[model samples]
Target: MSTPMWKRVIARILEALLAIVFLAPLVWVIICSFSPQAGSAQSDGWGINNYLTLFNYQAGLPTYLFNSIVVSLIAVVFSVVVCTLAGYSFSRFEYPGRNLGFMVTLSILMVPYASLLIPMMVWFKDIGLNDTLLGVGLVITLFQLPMSTFIMRNAFNAVPKDMEEAAMVDGCNSFQALVKILMPVVKPSMVTVGLLAFLEAWNNFMIPLYLSSSAKSTLPLAMVNMRQQTMGVIDYGATEAGVVILLIPCAILFLVLQKYYVKGFMAGAVKG
Candidate 1:
């Protein structure tokens, strides 16, 4: 079922074309971030000033970066721990209404986050979780749990039942078997879940804005305020630089965890 030579050539051409189309904007942004306003780079003087200005700003890019990292890490930790436990239970244990319970959790994934905002805000206020980083992190964690749990469940479920049975034969209890054997098999899922949770939390805007007060703002909200306060002349240069800054950690994270991400997906998808 190999493609004809002409078809293979066409496919390759289409792929190259699509790659350029997709990468064009990213290349343009990188160019602009280094481009100067009036010289040669302006007169051959386009340097990393925009990136420098991003650091030069009052709040300092580092502070915003730290905030994003802290909030995302908190949310990611909650997501991994809670979702792993819930996913393991769903995948490995039997109990009354287990299917119904899973269905309920998965149901939340279908609903958009926008739909939950108002009710969540009210709940946050009632709990005194409002106007705080913890509140925003918790909100992001809540939204992330259902989908990540589902992913982890599928991942753990894909572990062959024989492995668990073998462990039991060797005197391993259920908890011991999970920790000693199954958890390693599902490590890829853990990386994937962690990356996804971190990205979602890092990029979240509405929850942070709604939950934070003037004294505290996550990077996304801060970016918005920075734009507004600058009036019409939004520093596309600086903004682009900031966006590059925002993207740095996400890039590093994916690069570091991409192998696990791929492994987890393949394991889940190919489960027999």
Candidate 2:
């Protein structure tokens, strides 16, 4: 089956094209960020001044970064806890409405975030949960829960039932079997779900816009205001620096859990 030179070449070409298409925006952002401000003779020149300003707190970046990190982390933790329990229940327990319940979870996944905005705000306001980090975190957790649950459910299903039976025979209770054995085996899936949830919360703008107070504006909202303020200026160095800051946590998270994510993806693909 090694007679596919033309096909291999074509595949490589297509991959390269896709990579360029995906990377063009990031490359442009980096270039624009390093470019000199208008009226400067040195156009397209690179400098670290943008990063310097970011660290210097001229743009309230520190507060934004802190707010984003706090909310994203909290959201991830809450989502993981809720989803792991629910997924385990759905996977192992034969209960009434199990299939119907999964269908409902799938239905939630189909609904776009935009459709829930107004109703979520109204509920948040009624409960006095508005304009707070906890409120934003809870909203992010709620939005991400169904997807994470679905992922974890499939992960749990992929585990061998024989192992659970053995654990039960060895005097292990249901909780002990899950925590001591199954949880360790499915660590990769948990990591994948957690990282994805964190990214979603970190990049969230609409929720933070409506739910976060001015003093607790997340990085995305801060970036929006920065863009508006610098509209006439040719220099986008600071803006790019902000984006770099916004991307750091996500980049680090993905790099650390890339192996797990790949494994989870493959496992889910197989199940599907």
Candidate 3:
């Protein structure tokens, strides 16, 4: 049965309220970014110039931004590839220890990442992976894998086996069927997984903080630098601008992929 009219009205009102509650902080940061002297009594420093000033230091934002971009993009590619393969195996193949392997992978999510920091640092150093972007990206990909695999497995399970069989009848092998036929069917889930992987890698601070050296710091580290520019004083204006810059890519990605994200991904996830 349909929801009652009064309940529907109340739900819509609550939804609108929740949207405002979430947007409030972002709106404040945007406003404060343009503020000339944020956290000051004068309030005289409010304008669009903070954005322009972000790239004023050539070595600062640009280099860090490049590091972040490279790390995130690499992590996305690796995560999506591994997750797709793992998910396909879980969905299509029956093997001994399969369920146990999937369960072990999922168990990674149960442990606190913070708790693993010390061990991760020691392990990376021992393996000569410390102070490298590749190491950072690799660790990020591992962190994202369990969720990505879960999503992809559900997506693949939701797909009809008949389609792959039909493609095989057309002389396509399993890999070809996956690449040419089945992949299109699950592209939405792929986008969701890639977007999530990118966002997580992009926003990751502690990983980079522990693993990175001074020469190869990421954008989030740059934001931290902005926060503590001087010993006693912080530049709130630049920091807010950094926050905006950091947030823009995530917002734009969701806006662009919102259709696939909201529709296909969830429906597939709802399947076994």
Candidate 4:
């Protein structure tokens, strides 16, 4: 290993090259988002005019952003809560049809996602949940459940049963032990589930397309609508601006939670 200076240097060079290749498109988008374009509202000069145009489009950036945030938060909370309980049950308890039930939940993943949305749209409409942000969030949560449950169940299984038994011996009820002890131990998995749920709900287009209205559109849907111009011309400047806006939060979230997210997956993989 000490004699491998040349190999290390070559590896560094390759990594730099790969980074550049990956970053080039993102850099281009950021630059293009600020550059003035023909027929753009801010064609006067290079600036944030494209961003201003995006801000003013449709019901405005704030409305779409709020819609996206609300839906994503709902999905994150619902996914974490439901998956945590389901995973714990599947891993710790023996109930009739338990294996069959878990199998059914996982089987949902085998179905086509797009096909599921159409029939769900009809059901949601019948329940008066159609055309609402809550409906879209529920759909996102449903899709996240299978994978989230699997991750959580494995995470719970990775922990020693003796810890739970010890807590019970100390007079803590099962629910109390889970809440005060096991939940903290599994925090990383919960974070992983929440983050995945948030990202899916934030960027999901199909669910919103079928379940939400124009007024309740999320940022991705808003971006698609904003890209169209009169006479079929695409507004590249504002579109790039929208792309940058959409990318920023996701990038920041992943960077911030990278440590926990990796740990969560590793914890789950340990037992299964």
Candidate 5:
């Protein structure tokens, strides 16, 4: 280990190269998003005209952004709450058909997501959820459940049984112990699950496509609609602007919670 100076240097160089490779496209998109292009609403040399165009399209940027945020937040809240309880149940309680139930839940992952949308669309319509933001969010939450449940289950399992026993010995009830003790211990996994759910719902195109109308479209659907010109030509500039808008929240969220996300996976891997 003391004689690895050259190896470290090589590793650093390789890391730099890989970073460039990954970041190059993002940088290019950001630059191109500002560059002047034909059919841009603003004829100024270089500015935010592309963004302006996107902002003014269809229901407008604010509406689409609001829809996306609403859907993503709905998915996050539902996934975290349901998965937390489920994970706790699976880890702490012994029940009939527990393993079989878990397996059945995970088996949903094997089905193609798109294939179920049409059938679910009909169900959603009958239930008064079709063409609604809540409907799309629920769909995203359903798809996210399996993996989120797995993560939370492993996180709960990785905790010590003695912790729960200690809490009970101190007179805390099961719910109180879970809320006051075990939940805090597994916060990273919760954050990871929430973040994953947010990203999935934020960028989902197909769910909204099948279950929603134009008024309920999220950012992804808006972006696709923005791409069409009067003559069927694609508006690349406006499209890139949409990419920048979409990338910002995801990038910031990931950067802020990256440590927790990695720790969450590590916690699950350590014991499971």
Candidate 6:
């Protein structure tokens, strides 16, 4: 069932073209970020000045970047732990309404975040969680849970039941078996869930904007602030530089976790 040589060549050609098509804009952006203007490599003797200007601007980026990292980490950790545990339960334990429960878990994705914003805002405000990174992180964790849980459940379900039985036969408790035996088998799903959760939390603007005030913000909110401040002035060069800075972490994380990310998603899909 191998492909014909001609088809293989066509696929290689298409892949090369598609790669260029997708990467060209990113390359252009990177080039522009280093340049004071388009089609120039900061010819006016530029070198990371644009980057410095962005971070050093009034109400500078350090605090906001800290906020983003803190929130994203908290959210990612909580989301991954809760969802993975939930997924294990869903995949391994059968009980009444299990199917219905799984559907309900996934139903959140259909519920628009905007629709919940007002209610969530009011609730958080009343609970004294508003205008805080903790609140934002918790809200992010809530949104991330459904898909994370689904991915994890599928990952666990895909693992052979005999493995768990074998581990138990070796006198290991359920928890020990899960941790020592099953976890390694599903490590890819865990990485995928963590990466997705982190990216979502890091890139989120609306949640932070709504839940946080002027005194506090995440990177995404700070980016918006930068846009507004630079709007009339319109310094595309600095803005693009800031964007490149912002993109670095995401790109790095994806590159590191890509192999696992694909495997995790595919494992879930195959199981489903």
Candidates in order have lDDT scores of 0.80, 0.80, 0.84, 0.91, 0.92, 0.84
Per-residue CA lDDT of model 1 for 1-272, tens digit only, reads 88799999999999999999997887787787787753211224677877666664567767777778888988988988898889889998999999999899888888888888888888888998877678788889888888888889889878888999999999999989988998898999988888998999888888877777645677777777665323365666766666776777788999888999898677677662
Worst 10 residues of 2 by lDDT: 37-46
Q: Which regions of candidate 6 deviate over 4 angstroms?
A: 37-45
Error of 4 at 113 (Å): 1.6
Cα-based TM-score, every candidate: 0.88, 0.88, 0.90, 0.95, 0.97, 0.91
Ranking by TM-score: 5, 4, 6, 3, 1, 2
User: Candidate 2 — which residues are off by over 4 angstroms?
Assistant: 39-45, 52-59, 230-235
**Best candidate, TM-score:** 5
lDDT (tens digit, per residue) of candidate 5 on 6-121: 99899999999999999999999999899877765544588888998999997899999999999999999999999999999888899999999999989999999999999999
lDDT tens per residue, model 4, 92-195: 99989999999999998998899988898999889999998888888899999999999999999998999999999999998888898899999999999999
lDDT of candidate 6 at residue 7, scale 0 to 100: 98
Cα distance off (Å), candidate 5, residue 224: 0.2
Name every residue pair that clashes in candidate 4.
Answer: none
Task: State, as a TM-score between 0 and 1, how close model 4 is to the true structure.
Answer: 0.95
Q: Candidate 3 on 25-129: residue-level lDDT in tens?
A: 999998888776844322475576666556554466788889999999989999889999899999888999999999999999998787887788899999998
Predicted model with the maximum lDDT: 5
Q: What is the lDDT of residue 111 in candidate 2?
A: 85
- Scored by Cα lDDT, where does model 1 land? 0.80
Model 2 C-alpha lDDT per residue in residues 1-272, reported as the tens digit of each score: 58599999999999999999998987777776667765322244667777666555434667888889899889989987888888888999998999898889778877887788778888888998888888899989888878788888988988888998899999998889999888888788788788888999899999898777668888888766655343365335666777877777787888888999988655555663
84-140: candidate 6 lDDT, tens digit per residue: 889988999889998899899899999998789879999998999999889999999
Cα deviation at 62, candidate 2, in Å, is 1.4
